[model samples]
Target chain A: MRSQSEPTQSAGKRAAPPYEQIKLFLKERLENGHWTPGALMPSEADLVAKFAVSRMTVNRALRELQLEGLVDRVQGVGTFAAQLHRVSSSLTIRDIHEEVLERGHVHHATVHLAKAESASATAAQRLGVGLNASVFHTVIVHYENGVALQCEDRYVNPECAPDYLSVDFTKITPTHYLLDVAPLWEARFAVEAGLPTAREAKLLGLKITDPVLIVSRRTVNRGVPITQARLVHPAGRYQIDGVFKP
Target chain B: MRSQSEPTQSAGKRAAPPYEQIKLFLKERLENGHWTPGALMPSEADLVAKFAVSRMTVNRALRELQLEGLVDRVQGVGTFAAQLHRVSSSLTIRDIHEEVLERGHVHHATVHLAKAESASATAAQRLGVGLNASVFHTVIVHYENGVALQCEDRYVNPECAPDYLSVDFTKITPTHYLLDVAPLWEARFAVEAGLPTAREAKLLGLKITDPVLIVSRRTVNRGVPITQARLVHPAGRYQIDGVFKP
Candidate 1:
């Protein structure tokens, strides 16, 4: 493929903004992994001279990149590359249905199964309950346009909500139900890349080695963990979000 | 290399536990980007036959994989691969010192510049304050082991905290000083990936096109935002953490 930014001056005249061109060039470099994480670039003056743009234009491109968390700038010093580390933010925890609808996409769910069950050792530890404690397990297959999208397998502590199993998961989501029952005093979550097994691959209509997005959440109310649930979404479907207090 | 698993067959002849072997294999694949996010694998029965293991063993591997947020399984259907989306979880949020210490590394910071100033239009809008509001701006360069790491540019709302310029940011972090003065009610934050410009790259000792982790936060007290800060960290050095209810 032709270079998106080859510095074709075209007689040193162009219609687009110089800063935009520089921005596009740098963006293309980043996307193509040319610069990579933790790599440094040329100085402002250097960029100006090379790109045949003013210092202000180069500053704008760099300023925006810094605001977007792409670069780090220091006064009396040169610029450097930024290390793109794992991000944990607050924008991802909204209800999936609400999120999808907010994006102007249709969303729906199919309750595959729901029931009361005994907690396993892992669940006991994570939920802070005794082994075999009465827990509510629910399995739901969410869909977008009748296509399987997510498989939500949740385990709720009955001590937090005794009537968990009695509620109809088909009408309301586990998130909404849990929030209604316990009011979400606090929560802890994690996201990571994962691979699905044959069963899961078939359900999502993906091939082996396709990436998946997994989110694990644990909720506490008054210092007591009310429930710990894991929500699974197929690749290219969902993301995570959160915020930090200064 | 030899398999990293415990033998579990008949007293003397059992092969490695399927879960351990599977986990190891998948770990290798992920590190190699073979079974990247959203990749699927064969079914339990197929894996069992392929590895010559019992269905129970394969079940154990698949079960743990789900807990780790690797796959999505649906009843009466198949499983699907999960995507390793951008850093989206709230689990990586933490104090810089804590994070560095947790990694068995050293942490340090150098205040490149710290001064009080007025909030710009974007800052005022984000903080939900009056136009041209008086604000405290502090720019810092955080480092890890003499390696320039993060460049933090912060703007504090003077309306929320009147004595914004009295403290010494050289000795303490803005986070520490802010918490001491304002009892936080809530915080909204965001994180993203991108590249940096010439000046920023110099301070962070990064190269061009290096991926950067940018964290922006706004804290509110009684429905009024007191501070809006942007923290930039080397993508390799920083991660955010959180827990979401439901």
Candidate 2:
């Protein structure tokens, strides 16, 4: 059940503090049915008495457990184990190059095009720039273990990353370079499943009937629109995984 | 920017509280570049003095703003605006029928198959049941305004919902019925993009060249494995939308 997500990894590496031990101890009891879902948990005072810990320690333990969806708390009532009817999940999207290298695979990039262009109406709106504004555009194909994995088509606001076109894209990913130049403060994303365009299919060496996953994003930093990017991936090699417990 | 994501709707619907007013006032200033990201925000005491509000109110405003990705709080230093470098996004997977209706379209369901079957090895593992145990299986095609949108293939553990196969699927969604029987306590979800199988294409009335977004989820309730469902949507008819501010 413990895959790549965040809660337990750091908690496991540290020596057990009193609060951490309390949380784990209670979580174990709750999981083993010491209290059924929605059953009232012991009051803070009762827990303080039983564990011989400070009220703040018990409170912190309960607070964290609630945050992790292990328990639920109601105002003017006692804490209780969670009893959710709706599925809740969090997804963490990681960098492709980092993910590939962690899996012991080599990552390579092929630069297709990099140059300045006048923004189209759609591109201008997405980047919050005026129409016909000078913006940098780049098309790059990323490979994992020499297999075509992702093709990125991007439009960057000259104000956000002035050197977007000058950098050799074959040497550095546009995502890494852009992030280095302007930290992401806001974004909007949409994902569509579709067959790739003819140009995309040719670049990725894909069959005509192959499916592709497309993700488009618009990013903003410090009130400045940064970039608009569309990423395409072959379906056979990519999936987004998410896990939830509540 | 305000499409479907949280943080501002309720704050707008209700009359602005003192904290809400303060939050908006500061957010407007920040978004207009009165202060760059990472610049020190006014200290709590300073805010209270300037706004003539209580310290608690000012603190609440700052806290909520931080939670909304509009600000970042640093202990022992002043609060700062968000400075995220990575794109953060959230995808909300809602029921197809509800989404269709929300679009002012009609929804129809055609049940293809519904019966009890001996669990195969993979099905047994997915449902956490014994191999060869009885499990309920169903296949349904969903339509929005006469256009096929989703094909749902589901396997339900008999123990989790004893009346699963007896229900009238045409009248009720499997998801609604399952939640009524056993509230979802845990789930794992995987999303894949691919050309649908011949059978799936037929169910969705999609062409062989059409792509599909396939979302598979394993659900559990009260520590018992409940159901595993795979939902396939025609790429052209449906898309998953997500928005993020940081």
Candidate 3:
């Protein structure tokens, strides 16, 4: 996408302040992973020349990003994009499909298991249901570029999503369906490193020795437990990385 | 949430196995934060006497707890409760000591390595310093109740925190020390899963087979890189978990 920064400097009637426009332009590239973490950003002189703005305006934009933890600047040294990979400073629980697609990549799911099962001890406690109660189960392997990215083992509260079993998970992810059926009010997440179980290793095409990042999340809606999901990703390929402003 | 009061009402002969009874008794104390993380647990002999069971039964009970990462059993030292801290939200970068103390537990640190080192390729790039530049390096093992929870391998920009190597890490955390010298501007964080290196495994007293949760953090101040830290925790023993509201 073309940066809107160049024309804004010449357009006197533009509503956005010069520094705000510069911030927007820089933020877009950073968010798109274009600059990447530790990559040097444009020098203030370069930005001033390109945007046709004073050094002060360019400095303000860089200063704001530095304050927001998106960029790091050093005296007599160039500014660099702060570490951005594997970061998840965004406070939203987004679907894997959306995350992949947002990066201009294809995201597909291979549903291996989708059925209702009697809640095991873990499922019962995580979902806050009676022991042996009916819990909707789905095991899906999400793929990016036909390579497995995540093994999503999710247990849903039947009361929250009665149609969970019937939905074609290959098209609609469990996260997407659950969001439509039960608006997530809050989330509790515990992240750890673990060896994938035998079944997970097989489905994800991973060796048992390969460590995977596991995000165990229990989501609630209106004070009621809705779903608990175990999302596992390859250690070398995926991580929760990002920076955020308070 | 099963009420176990009925079994206690009899108080004559417990239905549970001797080991199970012991487990429940210990679990109650741990959950109530009475024992606190890192606090030494009762010895096997003491447990056996209290539960009126054989040492074998108490051994079995403690072994189970150890596997679950609830307690640490040093070969020569006594068993201590594992860290159940860091339950911090996404917004804050908290000190490990503060996290432990918040749970009413004791916190301590062992400074394994603290000195100036030439920046390696990874360190130079991460800290945005020239290759072979002098960088402050430190490796510290943080404990909660005497149970090692985190192995922190940290690199600091000498320009930002000149007195990094001089401060006694056993008394003050790097996080605490850096904040005073270099006011934190912003932070970048990435959480992953991986196996620890030989040195890390040794420091944390973990086997090579054990998985570890790794949090790589880059903090900047006034647009300058302050410190980049690699924090490793035993997968089964420690995790980053919490609930947050929008």
Candidate 4:
């Protein structure tokens, strides 16, 4: 591939810049699956020799790829193809199982706790129910391709979903089931960075000190609170992405 | 104050629940400036005696307040009124100074670094400039009422904002200036939770171990890359809040 001293003339057109050529070469390889995720590409010196360009040119190509989220470069370690982490915005409530499967990855859930419990004052107030009212509480750890991705702690008002406890959560996510039972009319959400509690850390398989991206959401159906959930994701593994107009 | 309770009948209505009455009482005190931020509230035992309710009711009331972000409950240290933290969402890009003033808080900026430098490989790629192209970089710490709220590190493409370095940043934030110079056409943003770098921690007056909420944004004008910025906020002090319809 390096033998072509002249940038391949597409119908005898002017050659693209050396850096652009190098970037396209690497991008094509990535797209063709020749270089799998986590596979290291050629070093700067190697790329320069192959492209017959200055080392700065090769560096610029790789840097652009890194900025585009295609590669990860460690100071001491060579550059490796990066696995793109999916970004979710709080603008839309998406079913995690569907999201995972849409990415061509396997999805599974481990139901840690699902039971009817007396609502704490906080839950009761948020749910607009009398204190100590029966509420269905469920905690599930969602895994994508066998790796834990989200820890969902949810409280469902018993009046909205009386059969919440009888559902087989492993087969269908609580989010899906709840949406079916109580169509969402409105929701208020807050996203924050927080250190996970010990139990949450253990369930997410994260370090106690590691920060987690927490999305606290309360959904209402017809002006009545149906469910409130706290979704936790490991900091390094997840991000929220959105686009906005002025 | 609690001697003639009878639920403190307002217009001789039915008495509110013990916890609801306590919640309202505390909320009134907080709103009327009787209890200031960070001021410790009466002990649970005191609340129980004052309301003529069980200890459980007082505990529940405080817990609810804590969950609502209105109070901080330290296990052994007691509950104290919490300073309301600001939350921003990616949906809209509001001027920080405007946001602070709207909240009745003073806003100020401390310009840390403002200079022209050759773009690093990363910046060059993100800004779509040639290798070693001149780029204007600025670092500013934004404060609200003398408390550091955000540390903004921004890189501007010289082609987009030629007068970037000449502007007095302390008087006008880079964000404000940039918005004026380049009317935002479109923007892409990603928010993540991570540990701050040493310089970011120092500038934000946060402990190195503390996590931060980071929002990385890249704005374009007529499909041309203009500026890329990383806005960092101390996790304990900031959150991102948003509402969306299905």
Assess every candidate by TM-score.
0.39, 0.78, 0.65, 0.61
Give a tens-digit lDDT track for model 3, residues A1-246. Answer: 435546353446656887888898898777555775677999999999888888978987887777566789999999998753213233333578887898799999999998899999988987778899999988999998788999999899988888889999888888777756665545688888988999999999999989999988887755777888899998887877657432
lDDT (Cα, tens digit) per residue for candidate 4, span A18-78: 8888888887776554665578888888887876888868887887777566778987779
Candidate 2: Cα lDDT at B107: 88
Candidate 2, residue B22: lDDT: 80
For model 4, residues B62-116, the per-residue Cα lDDT tens digits are 8667755667899888888765321111134345787789789999999999899
Model 3 residue A6 CA deviation (Å) reads: 24
Which runs in model 3 stand beyond 4 Å of their true positions?
Answer: A1-13, A16-93, B1-93
Q: What is the C-alpha lDDT of each candidate?
A: 0.63, 0.78, 0.78, 0.76
lDDT of 4 at B50: 79
| DockQ for the candidates, in order | 0.09, 0.42, 0.19, 0.19
Weakest 10 consecutive residues, lDDT, candidate 4 chain A? A84-93
Query: What TM-score would chain A of each candidate receive against the reference chain A?
Result: 0.58, 0.86, 0.65, 0.60
- Cα error, residue A201 of model 2, in Å, equals 0.6
Model 3 reproduces a share of the real contacts of 0.51
Tens-place lDDT digits, model 1, residues A60-171: 7886666555667788886765543322123555566666677787778877667887789987877777898887777777776666767777778777788887787667
How large a fraction of the reference contact set does each model reproduce? 0.22, 0.65, 0.51, 0.51
The CAPRI classification for model 4 reads as incorrect
Q: On residues B15-113, what C-alpha lDDT tens digit does candidate 1 reach at each position?
A: 665578776665455444454344566688777666766776777676565655556677656555544221223354555655666778877888766
* Model 2 alpha-carbon drift over 4 Å, by segment: A1-15, A33-40, A69-72, A78-80, A83-87, A125-129, A222-224, B1-87, B97-108, B125-130, B183-186, B220-224
> Which scores greater on lDDT, model 2 or model 4?
2
lDDT of 2 by residue, B1-246 (tens): 532311343544675767777888887777666766577888999887777777877887887777556688888988996644432655667777777888899988999999999999988987788899999999999888999889998999888789888899888889878766666657888787988779898888877678988888888755788899889989878887766752
Candidate 1 Cα deviation (angstroms), residue B110: 1.3
